[model samples]
Target: MEISAATMDDALHKALGKIIKSKKAISLDSTKGSNRELVGVQIRISDPRARFSRAISRSQLFSSLGELFWYWGGSNRLDQISYYVKNYRQESEDGLTVPSAYGPRLFALRGKNQIDGIVNLLREKPTTRRAVIQLYDAEDLDSALSPPCTCTLQFLMRQGKLNLFVSMRSNDILFGFPHDVFAFTMIQEIISRRTGVELGEYIHSVGSLHLYANQQSKAQNYLAEGYQEKVPMPAMPEEDPSAAMLVLVRYEREVRLNQTLPAFPCGLADYWLDLARLLAIYKCYKKKDRETIEKLKNKMSASVYEQAISKRAGQIKWQTIRQEPLNFTSQD
Candidate 1:
């Protein structure tokens, strides 16, 4: 079924409610755990565009964008992405890392640069329908510790606008849906800008869009919170989005290695610098240096500064909750 709305939250709310009405119950055993959920649902988010992108884990919005952008720039190092996204990847056999990370294939390291080529295709022929990036590897079906949910991303030009269409093999609508939209739409925005077309709809066609039993209640609460309140995330400046992404990647690398922030790159615009500074401020929170974070916060956009502070507070709260012993088990 298709649902249209101005923002992603409302569309997601409606989609979840529809799943409750229309989905079949099933259980599937997988790496993370057994998922007891309503299954076999397809969702098309009519307005998948973000105002203030959100995930069940709001912090994930920033982190996933960082990781996806890092990978899109043709870097396949999962450790780099894992550092930002907090996955803590365990090295794999055959000198591989993050066994199923999609970046390497997305850029076509095995064959061709699918993503970069896609940009060129759209730029050269706005009507091209063959602009595709393949992320799924069939060999991983049997061997991967964590198989990819996303199978392919298809970009289409319809009526002079660039639209993003993605097909996923499966999705946990509660925890995964928000982050998926957050990152994919950012991908759409970048491609749209690079192709010099206005951004259009985001069409998501999933084989199974389900809500695990564990997240059902919280998902309902999110619906009750509503989507009228909107926050705007700044769009990439008209200059090459790649330039800004590169700066962000460099800063993330330095922070990950415990190195001091390097001098800003020459010729990089303040648009990119603003984003890099946000990442730096987030690193201050990670280092638990409140003094540094305070000074950095003053340099950020008010909207961005507020988000960084809120996320930092949430991180502290989550860490506190994790430290507390379980009431029933620990008593023994």
Candidate 2:
């Protein structure tokens, strides 16, 4: 099954519709319950920047950014990622780290940085087919839990655009698909900028594209929302975003550790500063510092993040209410 769409949201809706309609039930030894499956599925996204879903239920904007930073930092530590997606703790073996984390595989696999290698490879030879990043290694087979769902990624420079091809062993349509597209496409754009080429389409190929039985209702709700207006994320600066990314990572650690934020104008462009501000907002949300969150929110330059931040703020408020101690006095 092949599906092509302008954005990830459209592709997700289409794929879910197909799976729900089929009603073919199958169980996996690795995961519990039956799942609706589509074998040999391929999807192409024309505009990778429109990666975030517009659906309110699927407002995974915050988690997606956390995952991207996790991968970029080349870390598999559960403490860092579990905050964003608590379920990731289940994938970790000893509650410390995930063995199959793509960060290590992509960056330090056998002591080689694939990101740098790929960028340099494309610069040296635009037409080379060897620009591939291997994620699933032979040693991963020894692990009992959390083998990589993705297999390999190949880059092709065609017609002056950098197209990315991703091969996955399996992809969970509801939880995994959106995050994968966002992170991979972000990498694609980063490479495109570094190579001074136009960003191109993202092609994702999966051996099994599936929706678990437990998540069917959620999937249905997403489908019932109808078509979402496509909202593309702001473009990255034309220059290499490596420096900005480094600064973003530094602030991410600061926010995560609840440290005082460094002075602004860290010599970064506004595009990157906005991302740092987003992280600060996330920290404020965690601390229940609504006042500071409001302050940071007003400073964001991009309007695309407004909805997600609003949603998160609501959630935090609800959580605070749930945690507040209630005193019951009998007035009878």
Candidate 3:
């Protein structure tokens, strides 16, 4: 379920065609320095997973509003948003501790109640459907620090394939378009997995996709170089029992880390301490080379020893050790 850059280019080309045929006059915004003008078609693609569908819809131009809010709004401590949207609320009860103020604006736009919307959608439509959540709130745009998007997203389900269509008011071809391509595609993959649907085409309809005056050189360079038409998608997981085991192992490790880490610690020192311990264990298990493992072990042991000696040192808590057999494959 990986997306290729060529697929992205093809979608962009299709969007350009739509815009040209429509004969729309796209406004170019250059308020920001460095000639950031809107150009090119805006498109979205989606599958079943509601959060994933929403992510694919918005990730194209700007990292999904959820992403912006998560990173900027200090809500990354837990996967509350993802859990809520995915209907795993029982498993994510810990997330209820997150303040309502931290919720992203898009959540409301999706529905009055995020969890209910997702659950109802899932129950009624067990099959994969193209579900979209939008964030261009008129009230927010009018009073906000930033302007809302002129274009809106529509998710379509056709023949069990999820397709995304974005109608953008403005497009900054050089700067903004690439983000839209990668983010939406990733969203496509996540939804595909959750809903058991194949990702089809991403349709973009751009009103104005332009390069700013200052970006002429950069645009020229891009035009001259031409985009590489094909990029390889990551290999899909194999269906063999052994392959399943590997995926399970990875998931288990992720769960362990998730459960143990404190809800987003404050600063670098705290982050480093946790990271050091995690890396040490991960490196020990993943690194096959004895030499590499030994080196990591020595470094980690020294760091732990130093911390123990420090006057500011607090309680050193270590979890019980569980060893799993390692299985290697050419894919690894």
Model 1 weakest lDDT span, ten residues long: 323-332
Q: How does candidate 3 score on lDDT?
A: 0.38
1-332 per-residue lDDT for model 3 (tens digits): 11122355444334333333444434344554343323453344332112211111121211232232242233323453342133223223355532222234334444454323433453367443535444445564443233333344455556776566655565655544554444444444434444455666665566556556666565555444433333333322322122232333233334234523222222323323333333333323332333323333344422322321221112222225533322222111
Model 2, stretches more than 4 Å misplaced? 23-30, 259-265, 318-332
Per-residue alpha-carbon lDDT of candidate 2 for residues 218-247, written as tens digits (9 for 90 to 100): 998999999888889899999998888877
Candidate 1 contains a number of clashing pairs equal to: 0
Q: Which residue pairs in candidate 1 have backbone atoms (N, alpha carbon, C) closer than 3 angstroms, thus clashing?
A: none
Top candidate, metric TM-score: 2
Q: Cα lDDT for residue 331, model 3?
A: 17
Candidate 1 Cα errors over 4 Å, as ranges? 20-31, 36-59, 87-96, 217-221, 302-305, 313-332
- By TM-score, is 2 or 3 better? 2
Per-residue lDDT of model 1, residues 130-150, tens digit only:
998877777868864657778
